[model samples]
Target: MLRSSIYHRPKNNFAYAYDEETLHIRLQAQKGDLQDVTLIHGDPYIWENGEWIYSTSSMKLVGSDDLFDYWQAIIRPPHARLRYGFICNDGKESLTYTERGFFEDVPTHCHYYFAFPFLNKIDVFSPPSWVKDTVWYQIFPERFGNGNPKLNPTNTLSWGETPTQSSFFGGDFEGVINHLDHLIELGINGIYFTPIFKAMTNHKYDTIDYFEIDPHFGDKETFKRLVDECHKRDIKIMLDAVFNHSGYYFEPFQDVIKYGESSKYKDWFHIAKFPLNPGNQLSYRTFSFEPTMPKLNTENKDVQNYLLEVAEYWIREFDIDGWRLDVANEVDHHFWRLFRNRVKAIKPDAYILGEIWHDAMPWLQGDQFDAVMNYRFTNAAIDFFAKKQTTVEQFQNELVHVLQSYPQHVNEVAFNLLGSHDTARILTVCEEDTNRLKLLYLFQLSFTGTPCIYYGDEIGMTGGDDPLCRKCMEWDENKQDLELFHFVQKLISLRQQSPAFSKGEFSFHAINESLVSYRKTLGDEELLIIINPTNRSLKVKFPTSFADSIDLWTNKHVSNDLMLNENEFVIMRKMK
Candidate 1:
């Protein structure tokens, strides 16, 4: 029976409150070991005539990785308290699993079951509801466009020039306003700008001032205009907040450098030694050991107030839609809690996205950020679609692990991205193979979570990591890959048109070394997504139930035995 594989816990993703009335319970068993599981649950206090009451609900196999199969069932307790246990059967054998241990037979005692205690409404992980339908477009402001060349830095190079660490091309808010039509054409509903605040570097992570826009980007009026313009076009704007650290030249940090001990603002940062050392030795904590970027002491009351003011100022002044926190993990939880409260108070529906590259359950508990950057999803996609290093089964397993790591609501709104300012562009990652990139986009757009497209990705811009990836947007029609652009646009259109793409239940129905297929079902509307990443053509046979299906991508009717070309993919809508 592989009894050792059976596992459950009372809290976290294993079991959680989906809402005030609904409790989500999850059980883990060895992959393919348990034929089925039934959740034995009820309000722990519900009793009649010297006997406790309970009900049994079947648990569906929600997801599986390399080692474990995750089983889930949604239960609504009338009393908002839950006591639950599992009755697992593996064809011939059956057993009851509980908090204490396993039982040969179903345990009747309430003490043997796991208890949720009570479901508090405040404890529910309620992120902004609008995030599920959002499609984000990430823009590195300096590299996006040059609307006003007059505001260019002294050594600013011409647009489309090869980029270096120090080069700038004066991409201002006006440029973004000028190109709103392009984004509208691509069907982007949200824009995430990487650190538009005033800073020393072209990439403005080192915040010189939180309140003002970078000169290269534009003034506050220009930014406000841009925000209004974006809102007018139904596009939400999310600005990056780099509260984890400030630039070396920041006034408070500079004061510390001037008066090591007596500076009133000395506690604003984590300064270890008296004599300020910028580069030689690590005198103070910095972002990834870069001395120019001094880490902020968020725990201090003064620093917290300062950052919180920054958080509220943007929404109150410019009416920005959200804040994408930079280095959000390094910051303390207390500050994030306060930050969420302050931001939500200003704009309740404002989206808060954290830049977390790994497991972000701690930050995503509804108290802090609504979603994270979803780098785990990005890495898995790159490994399978770009690097070709993982098998389809392995990729699906990795995805299952990610999906099961969070609650259903969190997963729906998670910030899914293929390429960003940090990583190499998607086309470059796929080695300029537009076919492979197309397949990657197909999967991302059809899969769960709110998908994001990096700036210039739709037009097939290709570059390597960091400075290279942050190249100027290719505005020349001759240079842009319009075919790829239309393909991405079509994918976004499909996502918007189909409820199955955004809010459907996701399940991988078929997987192999070369082919990966999944189904998204919401009500009667079903979407079957099939991707072929290999170089050889393959004949994919669909079930007789899918005999009448239409390809959403091409609007053509597909037969049961669909012959997919090399590196081809399709989104088929099942006919009613």
Candidate 2:
């Protein structure tokens, strides 16, 4: 009696039916030194459709010359799907059948065909493209709060010059999970955590170990709880994935430093004869001149495999929503290509963002990342309305270019943010102009792409950069900017009802020295937003066609026509 012999790795004891239309399988199987593996379909391996079928007739091996040796097959079934396996030709064995495994989940309903078998269970997951449309809020873990005092760093010091990077002030992951209501109140749907991986520093970007969460951040359970709670609230989490470099105490780097290149991990880094030569300065073999931040040689296969495993580990262990790849352009594309596949393979709806502040067209050509930070738009808004350094037309042009630079898919995914942890706070950028701040806030919530608001900007928080930008959360009763806060709240409410703010197609109307207007329309919804960037009150009339529009934000009905006073913005909705 020939009992069915099946070999399945990871032994989840279950599999899904594969879609006939999307039969492109990205297998991560190790092959012989021959550089390619063949799948001979149409052989009867497992009992299905009242008979056993083999491999040679099913899939055609793809990318035989490339490093990823993937395969694609198209099999049309008489009904829908069937169980099948491969006649794997690994140059040694001719008809060696891999053990029968569980069913593979198919994405959509396709005509049932004979089931196909492969080495690994085909797991279907792809990151969603709409993730970029989410409004992001970046939280600096340390300054955010101390939900639990026990998690605080051992050494605490006053806020002053020459601050030690390793010292922490008690902000933990639980703090973020607790204050999510505060963020929701501000109309942000996504949160970009600086870094939570285990490390000696408070920031944690210098990763000592990629697999473990920092005990200071409350361990794996806290992070898993945070991810679950956030998802329930319709919010997304973007973790900071620091692959550009590792901290001084990283295991692999430590191995190299201690063993003097004799260790197997020596190939993981680019080494010099005098690897620790301080005189070499910029040319030294560390990450971008930071001696503590040692750069990983991504071109090496071992390094790529290790980092990819780390990426998959998080999505599997913590169920994180997505990742913000820090210094993405600096890392090698070869590594990113493999990295993207591994990430999307786990959570097809996950998002991958790059931290490039300038034009990243070369990297965003559909293969590199889903989107990059929109510093250009943020700067333009700051200059024209906040600093008054440029004319409205210039600002308008900058906004147009931001959209035109990428495809519609990429444009909608771009992170539209102003005043991140790296820049001056929005309040400071606007020079404390309550009116200008209102206008900017109105625009951000109404503009295209995902909007990101730095913490405390709504309450008129002002800071320059670094230490100034990283102030602790101010629960001060006397200093809260209620008026500004309410205005922002109103703008956010308007955005919730306005398609132009969320998914509308945008078009520029007019942009002058002191005025700029744009229109956004999605399906049946239409909106016209006009801004006046001056101090003294200035009245501007809308076109005759939009005369019957109503100001949803202000609740001021425009029966015939409307006017925008100085520094005033009118969000007019087209009446049915």
**Maximum-TM-score candidate:** 1
Q: Name every residue pair that clashes in candidate 1.
A: none
Clashes of each: 0, 39
lDDT of 1 by residue, 1-576 (tens): 998999998878888988788888999899999999999998777888867788999999998999999999999888888899999999988999998888988877788999999999888888887888889999888888788888989988888889998888888888888999999999999999888888999998888888888887889999999999898989999988999999988889999998998999888988898877886788898998999999999999999999999999989999999999999999999999999999989898999999999999999888998999899999999899988899999999999999999888889898999998888988998989898888888888888899999999999998999888999999999999999999889888888899997778899987345789998999889888888888888998876777768888788988977788888877888845
Badly placed stretches (over 4 Å) of model 2 are 1-133, 157-167, 278-283, 511-513, 559-561
Query: How far in Å is the alpha carbon of 276 misplaced in model 2?
Result: 2.5
TM-score of model 1 (CA atoms): 0.98
lDDT of each: 0.89, 0.67
Q: List TM-score per model, in order.
A: 0.98, 0.75
lDDT tens digits, residues 1-576, model 2? 011322222111112222332232222233222223333334233446654443445444322221223334444434333343433444543443333322233212111222344322233222265563577788888777677777766775543223343555777888888788877786777888888888887778789998888888888888889989898888888889999888888898888777864778887877665345435463336656877787888899999999899889988887888889988878988788788889988987778888888988766754567778877878888887788898766676677656644444566667877787777777887787778877887777777777877777878878887667777666564787978877877766666666666767677676344677888788777888777777666556677767767777667776543445688777777844
- What is the number of residue pairs that collide in model 1? 0
Candidate 1 minimal-lDDT segment of 10 residues: 508-517
